[model samples]
Target: MPEKYHISTTPVPPRLPRIGKYGIVDWREDCARCHNCVKKACVYDRHRQESAYLRTLKYSNFLFFECMGCFYCVQNCTKELLALTINSEYENLGNQYWTPEIIQTTWQQAETASVPVSGAGYRGKFAGRGFDAMWTDMSEIVRPTRDGIHGREYISTSVDIGRKPAHLEFKEGRIVSETPEILDIPIPLILDMNPPEFTLPRLEPFILEAVRMTDIIAIVDSTKWPECLNEKQRQRMDAYLPNIAFHLNSEAPEIPKDVLRKTRMVEIPDSDDALDRRAALREAVPGIVVSIRVPLNKRGVDRAVALVDQGADVIHGVADFNGNEINVKNPRFIKDMIREIHTRLINSGARDQVTLIAGGGIALPEHMAKALLCGADVVSSYLPFMIALECRLCSDCKPGLSCPAGLEAIGFDYGVGRMRNLIAAWYLQLIELMGAMGMREARRLRGDVGRAMFFEQMEEEIFGTLFGTRKQA
Candidate 1:
């Protein structure tokens, strides 16, 4: 067996003070001077830490808003002076899709490189939209240390990319079939290029460094060639080639043979001649995996299945930045689209011959595992890395606009360290999730909907016949 995969992480503190969710309001004027102050009984000891933190505070507007909202002090306070307040800054973190809680959780994981733990149990809605409507089966969780994050058991998160032959013909002496080319990575993740909305800073070098540290692949635009690299990076460009897969659009210039030869994969836009393009690329660079970037719009499912039927190596079905289907009034979410495509491929008997890469709205670590369960061989991660650099998913992230996160001023070490930390945290979380699900291999998690339950499907089975059918709101 190969060595166990691990990601080394160091705590990368946030540059600015975090906008925590909950805070405490103390009405000291009405205090009865009780012997046992309610603040002293905080399970997390946040009140004492808040007092200590305020002593060295430079800004009066900055509040100690790290309350866990356990409600122990609120209920036990004799004077009824203590109240829990939600931070307004926290409420305004992201848009409707990228909720403030998601941003905050991403920040915590990136800073600490550890799983975000809430003292109170999950208080959010049971099910809502997209990935929220799907839940993995954790009925097999038996022990605390069995999660494999602490080395109790080995849970493999590795997956293979590229085309795979359905079966091999065996001769009397040895195998007589030809094996297709494939690229195996330690993790089933690919750092995708930033969407057009997040055009804040040029941190390509840092992203490439993070990819190198994690030993995963990153997709880069072919048009942004050497401009994305600095002089030092250009000198050692060969070292980063294997981790980089240039995305070739129609407008991209012709890539030199030398560059394509060094890289393991490349992605081209979905077009009428996409198969021809794949053939030409394979002929140019033998053993190179070519992924067709299919936009997950209304026609995405059929396009992806068609490509798979035509012997494409990989189909990268991408949605809008927020994971919604583009150019549709009632757009299906990424999860639904992925399920459709995966189901189609499975029915056509081409699922095993081609690899399906899903992208868009993979904001959380659980989304990675969930995407695999929905049938993606790998997932493309985009916004999380930007959020790791403290991006607020603001509308004004253009070149000249004022960035609330101050992304342009970030140093190389701080930027790269945070991204690396986020990746490590996600990796460990994936391991924990796999262990809880009683799964030992990430490859087995693909298309394994038996280990998951869909809200729509369950609603249909349980209540559809009784109440007619669920109507769209």
Candidate 2:
């Protein structure tokens, strides 16, 4: 007989309920009283004695305590029974891409504010979209007894979002600054906005303040003002503008002739003569960054190359806020798009000079790490804010103030705190994820590119040539 997984050897977490009406329901319907009673013949004999449990009306015994839902009984049962079913608990982790397992895992960590465990031992599908298609490199498990967090041998998964100079010279035998190209962030997460989903002025301001206080820039579109707010709220926007970075007015960009700008960077839609246009844009407004917005798609590589050639200070590649790829055909997906652009930039020797800001498809905290493997310096997101606000993904915010998530009328302080807590939780989880991946510093992770494993590539490596053909030489 073939070996069994998820049972006999691995133990169920005691935190879960041991026995209840919820239990034994499956066993009674599926049990067969064969001589072996194959259901009783567990590999470890973990099944309880048939006579020890309460007998049921159906003439089948109920051994509620011993069944692990491992499907071992189902496999061996002559009655052809045993199945797993939903228990009517929390269903959504949000969005089709994020999946219940990932959200459940992250939320479990956030709710307890602690590390997670593989208690069920990976009860999900192996292949899917975005970061789900790639995995982190954890082959070398250097168990350091002395220092668990800062082990002797580890992987660094942190990243930075600025440029680096080629070479530096100590002018007077002292540390005179060379070219300061790179601005290193301690963590790889960035704060971005979906203003249509969040209408609170106070909430946005507080979120910006918190992020800027941590030296993390918040990406907001400032044109969402209702024109009905009091003067103080309007002023708050101006005050925060200079402090938090902005992704302003990409659809119909309007940089004033005098460039009355407060933002450190601006990510506009991709335009022709992008390089010369950026030079002119910078000339119009000094000390302001010029970024080009790239769609997160399979064509990410081509778009990135064009943007870089045009001299974009940054490339803000955004997938749909719900984490879907733009193109249906040849959907290389967002995680791979980031990696494709990163590798393209690295191969061109320009990775150190430009920032890659990837948003969209960033559903989980660990998506930040997955983004890093694809060579992004920073990752930004939105739906996490909705999830933070207890958004059930009913998708109602698009038509004016009819949001089903209740964001249209959400209280300022409560909504803001919830958003802050979500970001804060993500921050802690980011640290834990980076630490687990064997990384200590965040800046060294910029375009690190090797932090994850691509299952597609792995599949090709394992069976592509055996069953399929490689491109002709």
Candidate 3:
């Protein structure tokens, strides 16, 4: 047995005024002004914090909306002067995919580094799009000893990110076949570079810091090296080098041999000669894991299978930010793409040899586990870390635009702390989810659709013969 993987976290509060779901509306005009006010009896002490916040309020439109919606005050008020109201600003956060609720929940997790306990049960739809269309099996919750977060049992969330030989040969009672180097990370997550749509200057250092603290890998574009760092950070580059994986493209300048040798993994964009490039890279740096970044476009599914057939070590399939296929109408989701790729590889007897990394649209911790359940060895995150830095996903996120989050003005400690907290929250949540699913290992969770229920499969089983068949998006 090995030492359990743990992520130590401390509460890192938000700098900006929190955009919570519920707020208190006091109709002071009809107040009885009782000495024993209901506001005085808040178990969470939210009323006292709101009073302090109101005294130093800077933004007129931003009100203190930290009410927990316990409804104790609403029920106890004699004059019926108190009511719980929804915060308009909170409702307006993010688009349909990245809902306001998701953004607010991310904020809370980043701030507290704890699993969110919505006192009220889930009030959303029974079924929806994307990962929401599938639900994990939690029947094991009946057994308390299955809980891995506690000391009852140990659940392994670690995953390997390199190729494995399908079979081995022995000569003279010893293995004669060559052994491949395997890189194992405690978690099945890799922090990816933020999309060009919304980028903050001098933010890479904080991302690198979070990756280093978490002991995971971060995919960094090799073209922007040194330019993204300052004098002090550049001097301390060696310390950050081990946790970083350089991403190379056709247009990017050549990376030095020393940097590539220091890192455990490298990623290159998919091209006509992608396999040739992988072979060249492997020859240059022996035992280094090479990943091919494949965009989840029209040919993504076939392309992934083709790459595997050609002996690709790792294939990283990236969908759009919203998890849909790129440049296609009524696009298929990444979950479906992953299932297709996994099925293809398995049919070819190559699934265990090559690694699959899914990226884009992995916005939450559950999304991480869900992606694995859909057959990804690892999932990459780009937006969740940005959301940790108070990013509102506003229209003004581009360069030369006014960032509503003030991401440019934040210091390294504040930025890195929040990101680390978000990772910790996700780590704990993954463990709890795995425990509830009665899974003792992350690798076993891959393509374990038997432990998951898909709405499409259920609908088809119940109504498909009646309706002929429903079209897939």
Candidate 4:
């Protein structure tokens, strides 16, 4: 058996004060001044740490809100002087979709390469919008031995990206069919290009290094080409070509034949001449896997099916950065879009012939698993990596504007380490999720809705007949 995949991670502390969810407001005037005060009983030592933080505080108004909100101190206080208050800073961290909780959790994962555990149990609603509307079945969690991450059983998270042959053809004594080349990555996650606002000259190197460390592929725009890399980087690019995928558009300059030959995969935007481009790329690099990138709009599903029928090797359905369908007011979520595409391809009897990659709004490790369950063979994410590097997701990221969080000043080592830690954390979480679902292979998890429950489906089954269709607001 091949060696098991592992990610080496070390704790990378945050650059700024942590924006945690809850803060303790101590009413010292009502304190009894007891030597054995409830504040002293803090298991996490948050009170002592808060005092230390205040002594050397860089910003006087910046309050320490790292309290875990366990309520042990609040309930134990003799005079009811201690109370937990929601941190305003935390509530304002991210937009509605990328909530403050999500940002903080991603930060913790990036720093420690471990699952985020609130000392207090889940304090959120049972179901909400987006990915929360779907839940993976964890009935198998009762079996402790099924733990893939730390148990004796090995749950494979590896997936192949390329055209798969439906069946083998043979002559009397030998095989007579040609086999397409496939790229296999240990984890079903790929690093996507950063959005225009966050794009920086130094960012590419950091992304390439992280991709190299994780042994996975990154999607790079071909138009940028060799200009994006320095001479040294260009020379070393050949070695990492297998881990790189070039994204090509009609206007992009032609890639050198030698460079194309070294790369295992290339993605072309969906167009009328996409098949012609795919053919040209294959003619240049005979074994190259060509993936068609289609926007997850109304036509996405039909377009994906057409490309598959035309002998496309892979189909990538991409949504907006926030995971919503583009150009529509009532946009469908990426999950629903993926499910539609997967089902359509299956109905067309071409699902197994091509690889499906879903991108955009893949913020968490759980999101990766959920995307797969929705029918994507793998997922791509770029924003999480930025978050890993302490990016505050400021609205204005122009060159002239001063960066609120000083992201441009980040050292390469620190940035790369944090990104690597985030990937490691995500990989561990994926393994844990697969184990709980009783799935031994990540590939099998694709389109396996039987192992998951959709809120809309349940609502229709239980409440539809009596109440009719639920009205959308």
The root-mean-square deviation over C-alpha atoms between each candidate and the true structure, in angstroms, is: 2.1, 10.4, 1.8, 2.0
Candidate 3 local lDDT, residue 121: 92
Model 4 C-alpha lDDT per residue in residues 1-473, reported as the tens digit of each score: 55788988889888878878889999998789988999999998999999999989997667899998889999999999999999987787767787787888889988998988866577888898889999999888757537566756688899999988898899998878878889998999988877675653346667777888899988988877866554666788876777789998578888888888888889998999999988988887898888889988878777887888878879988888888887788988999999988998898888997899999789889999999999999999998888887676766667867865678788777887888899999999998898888888999999999989999989999999989988875
Q: Which one wins by TM-score: 2 or 3?
A: 3
Off by over 4 Å in 1: 30-35, 59-61, 143-152, 170-176
Candidate 3 per-residue lDDT, tens place, 438-473, comes to 888999888898878999999999999899688764
After aligning candidate 4 to the native by TM-score, how far in Å is the CA of 32 from where it should be? 4.3
lDDT of 2 by residue, 1-473 (tens): 22211101111122222222112234565455578775466553534532344443232321244444566666666776555444332343244765555555544432343445655577667776567777776543453421334434333334555445545668678757645334444456767776354343234654664454444566655453323223455665555554455454646455444323665665556656666666776677665666677776666569877777555658888877655567655455677677778887878887777888888878777787777667777888766665555444553445454643345555545554555555555665555556656665556555565766777788788999788844432
TM-score of each candidate structure, all chains considered together: 0.94, 0.69, 0.96, 0.94
Model 1's alpha-carbon lDDT is 0.89
lDDT of 2 at 99: 54
Ranking of all candidate structures by their lDDT, best first? 1, 3, 4, 2
Residue pairs that clash (backbone atoms under 3 angstroms), model 4: none
TM-score of 4: 0.94
C-alpha displacement of 20 in model 1, angstroms? 0.6
lDDT of each: 0.89, 0.57, 0.88, 0.85
lDDT, candidate 3, at 233: 73
